[model samples]
Target: MKALVTGATGFIGSHLVEELVGQGYYVTCLVRGDSDLKWIENYPVKKILGDCLKHEILHKLTDEFDYVFHLAGLTKAANTNDFYSTNATGTENLIKNVIKYNKNVKRFVYISSLAVGGPSMDGVPLCPCSPPNPVSEYGRSKLQGEEAVIRQSDEIPVTIIRPPAVYGPRDRDFYMLFKMVKRGYLPYWGKSFYSFIYVEDLARGIANSVKTEKTIGKTYYLTDTETYSNEFLTDTIASELKCKYIKLRIPKSAIPFIANIIQKLTKTSIINSDKMTELKHTHWTCNCEDAVNDFSFKPEVTLREGIKWTANWYRLHKWL
Candidate 1:
């Protein structure tokens, strides 16, 4: 089996590449010329240099691959147009090329975000048929990307995986939580609760689902069935790091405002107003029954265990 993966250098994509390789698939990483390869440097995989939206470069991009995983997407931008340009148009371009050049590929798997489906009402896991109500431009663009892929499902086999807040070793976003815990502080914000998955668990779920018959034309939320509270998350890290922290619940609405102010002062896109749009929500859980029923997808790590492992990695790298 040959697997082609875009965004192969990213946190989740790197893990997926390793998973595919371990499963006896020859993997090819589709990465940009300037993309950093530090993450996948140890993996035995082939690399093709190109931009997804560059038609000439993406020609025959999926040739000879048994599966194609499209994980390349813009998660943050200084402006809204960049989000649509890369997430929506770039995704459309890649899928169109796949259908035209590699129609015989077994599956074109798209790794999407839970943000696309927005927050579940009253903190319940979302039903698969729940109407999409994307709260952020990032979510809206990703939904458009999902729509583009679903539109082409008739021409090529496709599976969409909407992964929740994923964290593990090599993950930067959640690393901040661990850092705060290490410093004897558990920053609390509102009643915000989330569904999360260990990155490896999500990668395994994606790798297993692609070839399965039922997942081909469907979308699945790859997440731990359990939803996590902010308190649980900070406490877990504090325990693993052998640290103590003061915990207090700040207003959830207050966090986005602070984040916006920080971004303005730093002029950094990382914590911009766009991301705050999604952060303002208190519930972001999703149902994983479709993935479970369709592909027997199971997460091997408990939150406690996953957090411990992440803690160990941070320590080893002197990041904690």
Candidate 2:
């Protein structure tokens, strides 16, 4: 089997590429020439330089691959339209080209975000059937991407995989918390129930979606069996790091100011006013009972084990 993967250099996408190669699929990765390649540089997979938003670039590819994994999308943007342009329109472009050119493609797996479905109500885990109420611009854009995939259901055998906050080796987001804890400060925002999945387990579930027949034209939420709060996660990471840290709880009202200060200092804003909407939401837990029953998806790494491995990786790489 052959597979084409976008976002191949990203934290989750790189892991997915590794899993695909290990499963004996000849893989071709679509990435921008400027993308950081350190993550998958050791892998012996074909690489194509292209941008999903540019139809001309995507149009150049031949439909020789048996599977297409669309994982590329803008997660952070300075404005709402940028997110839609990249995440939603980009997905539409890819799906359109796949349907137009790839005749033998068996599956087009879209790796979506739990943000697309928004926070669950009353601490309940969101199922796929739950009504979406995306609060952030990024979430709205991701929901657009999902709708784009669903629009092609008649022509392409697509499966959508929505994963919650995913963290593991090579992850930059969650690693920030680890760094903070190491520096003797554990920071958290508003109270919220969050869901998490280790990167490896999410990759496995994604691969299973490709091989599983029942997942066609269906959506699956892949997450660990536990639901936790921000404090719990912070505390767990501190425990895994074996560090002492002062608890810093930034109130919801102050997130916008903090976001501005960070953006100004870094000259880049991964978090902004739009992100505050999600931070203030009370729940982000999702139910994965369908993934468990249909794809036999079981998350093997608990939060403690995953955190330990991630912290160790950061230390070894001198990122701490």
Candidate 3:
């Protein structure tokens, strides 16, 4: 078996590549010229350096693989156009090229996000069956990408996996929480709840989807079974760090103004008004029942265990 993984240098993609190699599949990583290759430096795999949107590069690479895992995407950007171009249009280009050349490719797995469902939908479980009501440009673009794959379902074996807040060792998105816990300072914003899956668990789920014949033309939400509220998550992190928790709740109305000021002062896109808006209003929980039933996808790590592992990684690498 052979697999081609796009975004093979990213946090989730690198883990997927490792899992595929362990499963005895010859893995070929499709990476950009400037992408960081540090994560897979020790792994033995073929590396193809080119843009996913380019037909010449994808034409050559797509023909040689039995499976294509499309994980390359832009999560957050300054504008909507960039998001659409990279996530939506780039996905369309890849799928088109694959259909034209790689007719024998067994599977094409698309890694999407729970963001496509927006912050919350009343009485909806945010399942694959739920209609997408994306609020942000990131979410909208991802939905568009998924649509592109679904449209080409007749030509390829397509599967979509929407993972919620994946975290583990070397994940930078949740590093701030680890840092806050280490420093003994953490904040609880609102009545928000979140779901997370360990990166390894998500990778396993993706790998299984490729192997499982029933996964074709189906979409699955890969997440931990339980959801964690802000208070519970902060407390767990504090306990792991052996630190005291200080709970602070800022008014939702004031977040946008404060976020604007902070963005102006920092001159970086770290904490902007849009992110504050998302943080204030979003309750990111999902239903993973379909994934569980179809792929036997049960998350192996609990929140506490995963947090401890993440904190340890930070300490080991001097990132904390």
Candidate 4:
């Protein structure tokens, strides 16, 4: 099998590439010129330098790959349109080319996000058939990407995988809290319920979707089938780090100011006003029943075990 993966250097995408290669698939990765190659540099995969927004670059590829994993998209941006430009329009560009050229492609898997479906209704874990109500620009852009895959479902075989706040090694978002724990501060927002998946488990589920015949034209959430509260998250990290810390409760109203200060100082989107829109919600959980029944998708890593591994990796790499 031949697989073409976009966003191959990212946290999740790199793991997906590793999984695909382990499955004996010949892999080709589409990457940007400025993308960091440290994660995927040693992989036995071909890398093609290209930007997804540029149709000319994507058009140059031959129609030979058996599978296409479209994981390329902007999670944070300087402007709202940038998210749409890279996530939505870029997805459409790829899907169009796949239909125009890759006639033999068996599956075009779009790795989406739980944000695309918004928070669950009344703390109920959302299913694939739930109506979408994206709360942030990033979520809206990913929803657009999902729509492109669904809109062209009849034209080609495609599957969508929506993952929640994924965490594990090489993850920077969740690392903020871990860092706080290491610094003798345990920060938490609220008692809000949210879902998360280990990167390795998510990668396995994604690979299963690529190989399964039952996933065509279907959307699935690939979580660990657990909804964790903010308190639980803090407690887990605190226990893993074995730290003593002050309890810090971040006020939702102050997030915008903190976002500005962080962006100005670090120029990172780890915290942003738009992302706060999603954070303000009380529930962001989803179930993975469809994935469980269809492909026997099972998440082996629990929250505690995953946290231990993540903290260990950060320590070994001097990132903590």
lDDT of 2 by residue, 39-120 (tens): 8889989999899988889875677889999999877766568899989999999999988888568999999899988988
Per-prediction TM-score, please? 0.95, 0.96, 0.94, 0.96
lDDT of 3 by residue, 5-81 (tens): 98999989999989999999999888898999999888999998878778778777557789999999987556558
Model 2, CA-based lDDT: 0.87
Q: Of the pair 2 and 4, which is ahead by lDDT?
A: 4
lDDT of candidate 1 over 117-146, digit per residue (tens): 998867788856788879999999999999
The C-alpha RMSD in Å for every predicted model, in order, reads 1.6, 1.4, 1.8, 1.3
lDDT of each: 0.87, 0.87, 0.83, 0.88
Worst 10 residues of 2 by lDDT: 263-272
Highest-scoring model, lDDT: 4
Clashing pairs in 2: none
Q: Give the TM-score of candidate 4.
A: 0.96
The regions of model 2 sitting more than 4 angstroms off are: 267-269
lDDT of 3: 0.83
Steric clash pairs (candidate 4): none
List residue ranges in candidate 1 displaced over 4 A: 266-270
Residue 103 of model 4, lDDT score:
63
